[model samples]
Target chain A: MKELLNLFLTFARIGALTFGGGYAMLPILQRELVDQRKWVTEEELMDYFAIGQTTPGVIAVNTATFIGQKRKGTLGGAIATLGVVFPSIVIISIVAMFINNFADSVILQNAFAGIRVSVYVLILNAVLKLWKSAIVDKIGIIIFIAIFSLSIFTNLSPILFIVGAGLAGFIAKRQQGVVS
Target chain B: MIYLRLFYEFLQTGLFAVGGGLATLPFLYDISDRTGWFSYGQLADMIAISESTPGAIGVNMATYSGNMVAGIPGGIIATLGLITPSIVIIVIVAHFLNKFKTNEGVQGVFYGLRPASTALIAAAGFSVVLIDLVDFDLFRQTGSFIQLMNWRALFLAIVLYILANHIRATKQLHPVIFIAFAALVGIIFNFGLN
Candidate 1:
């Protein structure tokens, strides 16, 4: 029960603090989950991130689910996911009630203009950090370039790219194992 | 009935909006087109609010849109629909796939997935830059390169990027500080001023 509460509180803090989205949550997740709690290693966190991206639903929720399930069980997963989304539920519900008044404010508009620019930078930083760990081999580089191009230029679903790359890697690994 | 529809729609979104939170944008746009529960303009507002506020953008968006449709209960139901798939899948994986953690095939899949995820994120970052800094539609209509870019936004982005990356003090500061600073500058400069 204590562990469940801890999971809820920890992820609640994470959910509350994250501003930009899933990618921007990386640093905070690292600080709280990896560094402080040692619940998961950096590599495991990265794996969760990768899995979260490929899976259906929001990456943050998916990740919270993964971590929580790893920690306790199904119930833990539900609590953590609930914790992470609780803030959004409360905040957005309030915003929805008074959206008209808030959306039209000039001060808020200008603030968002600036905030949007910073969000791009935050995402860029995340991409760079992930790139360092992700692109380690020739195959990795090829997959990166292929998916990057497809994502930028086409309307193709990212799910297809992820699945295809996974299959390609599986095949390539199998071949290497056979030869060596 | 409205709540049930909300649940079903959001469940579909949760099942298919792969990649990340932003990937749900297309689905939301579709929902707007089909249901008219919210207008495109309202969807834009939801995106802005979702991006700026704490928590996942997807979750915020679902909550906002659902509330618009059927009040607070609708929001709760929609969010629950969205996360149900994740919880179910992760539980199955956690319980049954523990042994596969170090399996060769699984490792290979992860190896490939890591880079692919990175690429997708980089592409997402690129589009954010395009949307925030460049106005291609404006340029196409006006046929002026200078008119295409929001120079002030670009300048602020560059400056903030440098500060966040290079300066020791600013680098160490929480990202919320930068976001707040940008907001203050935007207000003072009257950015986005028509």
Candidate 2:
């Protein structure tokens, strides 16, 4: 019971405080769950994050489900899902209730304007970190730049780019005599 | 008809948007073009609010877009449609997660997925940059590449990069700190929410 409560509270805090969405919450999630609590390992968290990225819905929620299931069981998954989602439900509900006043406030607006720059920085940092992790070779590097340029330059759907990159990576690995 | 389309559109987005919330941007842009339910500006607003608030940016945007389409009911439907697939997948995966962890095919799928995820995220970053930082249309008016740059935003990005890399004393500083500081600066500079 204590462990379950701890799981709930930990995710509740994460869900409550994190801003700029999943990628931005990731480092903090690492620190809290893996570093501080010892609830999960760094390797596990990385794996979970990788899975969360590819899986459906919110990364935070998906991650929480994985962690929760790992820790407790089916119940844990449900609890952690609730934990991860509770904050958003509450916060968004409140915002929905009082959003007009919140939006009209001058100070709040200014703060959001400034926060936009910070978000830009955070996203840039995430891109760099993920790039270092995902791009393993010269071919991967070429694919990265090509996809980045194509996405920026053309109106092509990212779905096609994603498919193309995956194929390129698969072929590159096959040529190198490794699955990668 | 529009409501059903909205549900299916977001369902598709939720199903395919790997790499989390930002990955949904391109799909949102495509939806905007197809449905005309929201403009690019409105999408930008949704992004801003989605990023600034709690939960996933994708979910927040879904909720916001749904609200735009048909108010509260729309919001609920969109959010549910986006989440259902994930819920089902997690439950099934949880049942066999331990066994599947060592599965080679699963490993290969994930290996292939990494690059694709990166590509989607990179595209998202560029789209946001184009919408928020650069003014290509404005450049067409000036008829010069040099005149088209939003130098303030560029300088801001550079400054942030340096600060992020250099601020060691507060290496423990939460990103919310930086976000708050940037918000204050934007206010002072009169970036205006609009």
In model 2, the Cα lDDT at residue B70 comes to 73
lDDT of 2 by residue, A1-180 (tens): 998998888888887767767877788898889889898999888878767776656787788888888898877876776677666655654555465457788876666655666666776776777778776766667777787778767877766776666566556556555633
Once fitted onto the true fold, the runs of candidate 2 whose alpha carbons sit more than 4 angstroms away are A1-14, A17-50, A53-56, A67-83, A96-113, A167-180, B1-3, B39-48, B142-147, B170-172
lDDT of 2 by residue, B1-194 (tens): 76787789888877767667776777787777777888765566566666768777777777777777876667767766666566667767767766667765555445555656676676766676677667788789988887576666577667777778876764456565666667767778766533
Give the worst 10-residue stretch by lDDT in candidate 1 chain B.
B40-49
Per-residue lDDT of candidate 1, residues B1-194 (tens digit)? 89889998888878766557865665675576678898754565566578778998889889988988998999999899888888887777666554656678877777777787678767756755676578889899999999899999889989999999998878977666877788898899988672
Error (Å) of candidate 1 at residue B194 is 5.8
Candidates' C-alpha lDDT:
0.81, 0.71
User: Candidate 1 has what TM-score?
Assistant: 0.76
Q: For each candidate, C-alpha RMSD in Å?
A: 4.6, 4.4
**Per-model DockQ against the true two-chain complex:** 0.53, 0.42
Q: What TM value does chain B of candidate 2 have?
A: 0.83
- Cα deviation of B116, candidate 2, in Å: 2.4
Top candidate, metric TM-score? 2
TM-score for each predicted model, relative to the true structure: 0.76, 0.77
